[model samples]
Target: MEHHAPTTEFLGMTFNLSNVLMITIASAIVFILAVVTTRSLAMRPTGLQNFIEWVMDFVKGLIGSTMDWKTGGRFLFLGMTILMYIFVSNMLGLPFAIAIDSELWWKSPTADPTITLTLATMVVVLTHYYGIKMKGAKEYGRGFVSPLKFLFPFKIIEEFSNTLTLGLRLYGNIYAGEILLGLLAGLGGAGIAGALGAFLPMLVWQGFSIFVGTIQAFIFTMLTMVYIAHKVADDH
Candidate 1:
């Protein structure tokens, strides 16, 4: 938790170097996985294609559960992409971490508030954009005052709340996992008995972190769909 992300300047602006590097790596990893998963393009769809198709079906089901396929289908890519990217990014730093004193050179991008918050804000903004685009300004505006006029303020507040919760939930869980792992890593440096004592816990904790990463990714995806549904669902 005390580890500071790497910092650097680019074109006069300061940036978190560790985050930029991890984000780039995560993006590349996702792109490569996507290419590999779909490269064969088999009609029968075996191996990677089969797995990709299964993911597609999972996304489809997730969408169908929330809204019409027409509305939700368009977001399947967004949902799937976010799910994969966040999951992979969350898992990235679990196996190992690079640190020099208190400076963290590499870690999970999703564990950072900036990355998670940016993603949350972007998704919320898109929901508003699509809501107005699909339903027109008049109908979208009506959403704010639905049921009663007093709700306008609450509706406005809801946007910020949604964004904060979406991002913070992911950050909190991943950060906790990272912090616990760091403590365990410290235990490994103690003595022979400490090393033996910490080894099994570290291994078990890492596996649990993977589960945490996956659950957080899914939760983020599900909330994204819910937020979108609130904005774009015609019946809502």
Candidate 2:
């Protein structure tokens, strides 16, 4: 049987209860992790602090590769926050998905196209905002037609294409992973013989899902910085 996400109407708009719940949980986990990792300032880091510092360094490198540190320094926190939130969100559905009375109450938030597309839209909007802010409105507008006026249409189309690719790529990977995981779980639950048969495949697929989740998060964050760099950096 196909399970549907519970829904609620708020402010005359329908919302998916499962998406909302999982998003909140993922955000809270990321927030708590940030707090716990940075609560104590130390000259010499250890344990969680060390791990977070390394992650921060990695984010910094990602930003640096796209643009100079001078231009990308301000985005470090944003990049780190985005990377952590998406990674946490991706992992939430891996442990287990919950459904009550045929209504799903728990799953990965990014598995929903609405959530992924919203994120992509936000990133694209931020890029435009930062572009205009950094380059001035006139200069930023000129970028669409730079090198040749004929390229304007292509440039306009690129924005839409970028948004769709960024969002849909993430949704496809996560949704498919969750679906396969659920199937494996069902197979395992059938009987002792089925359980034994499904056990190894389930374990292997679960591990692979974690890897896909991590890669998806990294790709999204990296592309975000790349888009911002194109706007903010002077050399296109």
Cα deviation in Å at residue 231, candidate 1?
Answer: 0.4
Off by over 4 Å in 2: none
lDDT of 1: 0.91
Q: Among these predicted structures, which one has the highest TM-score?
A: 2
Candidate 1's residue-wise lDDT over 96-200, tens digit each? 888887789778998899999999999999999999999899999999999799999999999999999999999999989998999998898888998999999
lDDT of 2 by residue, 135-213 (tens): 8999899999997999999999999999999999999999999999899888888999989999999899989999999
User: TM-score of every model?
Assistant: 0.96, 0.98
Candidate 2 accuracy as lDDT: 0.93
Q: Assess candidate 1 and give its TM-score to the true structure.
A: 0.96
Flag regions of model 1 displaced more than 4 Å.
none
User: Residue 203, candidate 1: how far off, in angstroms?
Assistant: 2.0
